[model samples]
Target: MKKFDVIIVGAGLAGLSCGLQLSSKGKKLLLLEREGVVGGRTSSYNLDGMDVESGFHRYIGYYTHLPRVLRKAGVELSEIFMWEEKIHVRVNDEKPLVLGMAPLFGMIKTIKGLVGNRRYLSLKDKLSLLPFFMNGLKDYVMSPHKLDQHSIKEYAAKYNVTNRAFHHLIVPLSSGVFFLPPERYSAYVFFGLLAPTIPKFYKMRVGAYLGGMTEVMCQPIADQIIKNGGSVRTHSNVESLVIEEGKVKGIRLEDGQVYRAQHTVLAVTLYTAKKLLKPVFENHPWFQPMFQLPLMPAVSFQIEMTKPAVPIDVTTFAPFTCLSSFAEQSRTTFQASKGRLSIILSPPEKFLDLDPQETLQFIIKDARKIGLDLESNILDYRQVNHEYDFHSLEPGFQALRPTQRTPVEGLILAGDYTRQPYFATMEGATLSGLKAASLIK
Candidate 1:
């Protein structure tokens, strides 16, 4: 029985950003979430006396909007410290090779390392990345919509990028961040990521929130939304959309409470949006595309040890390994040295169906490849799986995604999966949220 100018479902990055923007623009909005806390996957939890994120999250300097959104919430980017961009990629049983990404000219240094990497990449493999390097940063990241729709695997084959190149270089890079391998992703997404960081390729400038992402990013957004006269309700689930004559009427919650609004923003993940909106608005243009988009499942391993051994800020293991990216974040996650704590991001194939104890033990065994161990010094550990995360760009599936503004009247979509210039990521989530709010602005 509540009424507002706008009703936002799911207080994730997209929903929170949309609510904050709408409220600041003098609009009355109600933000609802099924969970007691907000921020979606960006949320963090305290474990072993340290703040551990849901997954390994790092802010690339190329993300132009994340900084702006944080500043609007009275936070400064300087609050977080920049990490030197040194990536260690281990290929099979061979020793890990380190890529130094600092000065603009340092790209050549890393390329030389790859070329000389006889066991992993060679001169031919290094030359195969010419297409990835040819696209200018502006064109690749901003204008990738027009590229011929092709799977990243297919595109790599056309360029003669060998499997060795893929297993050692491309897979770790693409799947490390995107969750799916080159075969499932679109070439545009590959270029979308390579465009921003490859030319100058300064990974050292990446930043992590000074006090965890939720406390520093999501909490501030929620605080601003409330300060602007908006109401954020947690543990409130909307069962279905109230539809009549192809237009959104309101929403009916699972508890039989009907909340009415002039406009409704479905800012949840793609899966939840499809479940709620399809049956209600079957004929809407957004319906068919929702089915085409996919979802991916992943797990994170949090390891607490008595001492520090893993020194790299961000490192990607080989494609054959169970882990994709590993980060040791004691500097940002704790008040002081609370023993060396690390986060391991892995694809579903690595930890699927494994119990928490089994998952933790498995990762510990795998960590030995990189000289990281917690078997003896293990103080605490936790494993989490994100069941409803979006599917990475699967072949031609990326093109079928709908934009933020749906064809249906009074309905707007906000999620990383919604078609946007940025790749599906936290930045994409923020942009999608802003785009949704702009529709009502």
Candidate 2:
């Protein structure tokens, strides 16, 4: 048994962010990770002499608070390149529409790309999406508490969204964030993220590191924690929280090691959080909402290319199979010359049960819609699958989401999936970690 000021569970984004914030306060802490490494799902790995990422993630301008945290951690903004946000969307086999997001001042081009194309969203569909898109989310800002009960599908019906709009604009965007289709996820979470509460802050730039996200961000932050007198242990899978009298006294690892702390931050995924806290969650009123938060699987695929495949950078899909997002990520990483391409596909429900060969083939076929020819690539590759990660942005879960401050005296929650206005993203995770750390002192 060991004792510390705090025992942080799961070294993912929320855990690391919480540790970073606490370290700045001069609090001694321990970050425990189950895997062999410290980087979370967002972290990258070396595959076949090429650096590929856990997922193709970008730092969106609307993230608002992440830049400040990175600066404090000594991460140089110059190392991150702000690529023009050109999202090439493929609606079925039709022509892919490229929408430039860059500094996020591209609303007109975005509307023109989709609405003007009139292939994805028709004039009728734009008229339907008008009330929601008008003023860029004014209604959501006006009544922040409303629309949680309405799914995107239900809300779209009021606007009479066409099948093309539902499949192309609605489902693709909905699954991109919520991991569920528009019919399944809530309309409020969608608007809350896309609809800017602070237009000044929300209207920023989207960027990626010139190197691996792990090498550039996660590992650097981990080193910062060590520099600030905090301990981080990998291969330390935490089994459960040592709760007594409705308070978290510490945590127990799978190997039977016990680490005691005055405060504990359970920063694992939403599914893992519910599982670990099941003993209390089944009974506690405040914790009961943990069950309301549904879990969804996330899968990432990558391939090394001997020759250039897709000329464009990124493409999101929904014109065919369950919605998916894919990108030729080699351009951003320090290992750009290696020509690494990757994609973050949809639910385990659609492909989780498929064999590895079948899965790879499926993704390759999907990528071809945007002119991505991974099969022609002549090098090594890899795939990463997690049983759960994202939270359901679905209807009725808004009122159920718990905040960073928990009912237990020494316990707190920190994760992208936890209650955050940002939804399940790096922004939500960063903010959650900040709030969790603040709650302790």
Candidate 3:
């Protein structure tokens, strides 16, 4: 068996980031990935001569750590991403309303947008949210745990947030961002993630990548690791950890190959981690929460259009539909996607069993309701589905998140689902990897 200083499993953003940080410290590293490519949830692949991403991901301005790691990998954020200043939201039959991307930085711009769209949120509805906002900021800093017990809907009720605001604003935000309904989503996870962005709002701008994430983001980081003398092996699936005396010795691949190392980091998803670690550490206190973490499926579609469908690159939210959120990627990232649409189907539970054609019909019907008439737009469409995609930010899940420093010696954990200030986001994944790297001796 060959040995190294550290062996990191799963070359997703977390594993890749961990390797980069460790290699920078001159630690001999081995990064293994089950998939042929890296990026994990943020990965992309070529389909029908066009680049299809795993999903539509936004690089929000409030992210501080992800940018730093990207810079270290020699990838400039501005060069790969196209920034957007506003978001378009369409609620029911009401005309679409525009909101500033960074409300705190452009307070006047945000206020003007909101005020101009009086039908979306009346003066009373807007004022009704003041108490919720004030208490959320306070609780986020002082006692975030207290808010985790209640769902966003229940918490909003305590502040007497108007029904209009709840349906118009909160519903879209909860469903669009998390793919979960407001009643099931955790208030603490929602606001806690927002609190960190407050300090960086002035410098923040939401951006969409200019190309496939794997080519522009993941590959560059992997190249940096190799350049620094670290090894990144793709299609190397780990079967299990080599635990001796309650400490991780290294990992055993499915092919019966064993690689030894002083330290091992499991940077895979929550569901995958549980499958790998449960048999050995099921009764262990540190691993108990790992089994309890909730996992959800994600579904998205990429449509090809004959002509430009959406005119702008901004993210559009249309709640209470099969299509919760979408973007015109042709305008932002791919010239090939021009006149095409990338959509995220929220409350994905209902559509999980539907065939691609059936799902596309539902989306077309929903789009027509919102005045988007996509049925007549000549084109092909593709659907992407992940059975166990996201970790739930549902009420009480926040407290169940494990820390990067595990109780087991020489073993570390890293993923967005792990205990981090941010939720299941790019920033959360990147930060978790950095935290795991910091734990290494």
TM-score of each: 0.88, 0.89, 0.96
- Candidate 1 residue lDDT tens string, 243-323: 878788688888999988889999998889889977876675557777767777777777666665455445455555566
Tens-digit lDDT track of model 2 for 302-380: 7777755556555455445533666565666635555766666676467667775788887777666655556867476
lDDT of each: 0.73, 0.73, 0.85
lDDT (Cα, 0-100) at 249 in candidate 2: 92
Error of 3 at 94 (Å): 5.7
Q: For model 3, what is the alpha-carbon lDDT of residue 80?
A: 93
Q: Which of the predicted structures, 1 or 3, would earn the higher lDDT when compared with the native? A: 3
Span of ten consecutive residues with least summed lDDT in model 3: 331-340
lDDT, residue 204, model 3: 57
Best by lDDT: 3
Q: How many clashes in candidate 2?
A: 2
After superposition, the stretches of candidate 1 with alpha carbons farther than 4 Å from their true spots are: 46-51, 92-95, 102-124, 131-150, 162-164, 198-204, 283-285, 335-337, 340-345
Per-residue lDDT over 1-441 for candidate 3, one digit per residue giving the tens place of the 0 to 100 score = 999999999888899999999999999999999988888999998767656788889998888888999999999887899877778887665567787766765677677876776878899998998999889889878887888888989989999999998887877777788777888888887788667667777865678888888988999999999999999999999999999998899999999999999999999999889988998898998787768878888888888888766667778888768778898888666666547788999777877888989999888889877878788874788788877867877888777888999879888999988988888889899999999999987
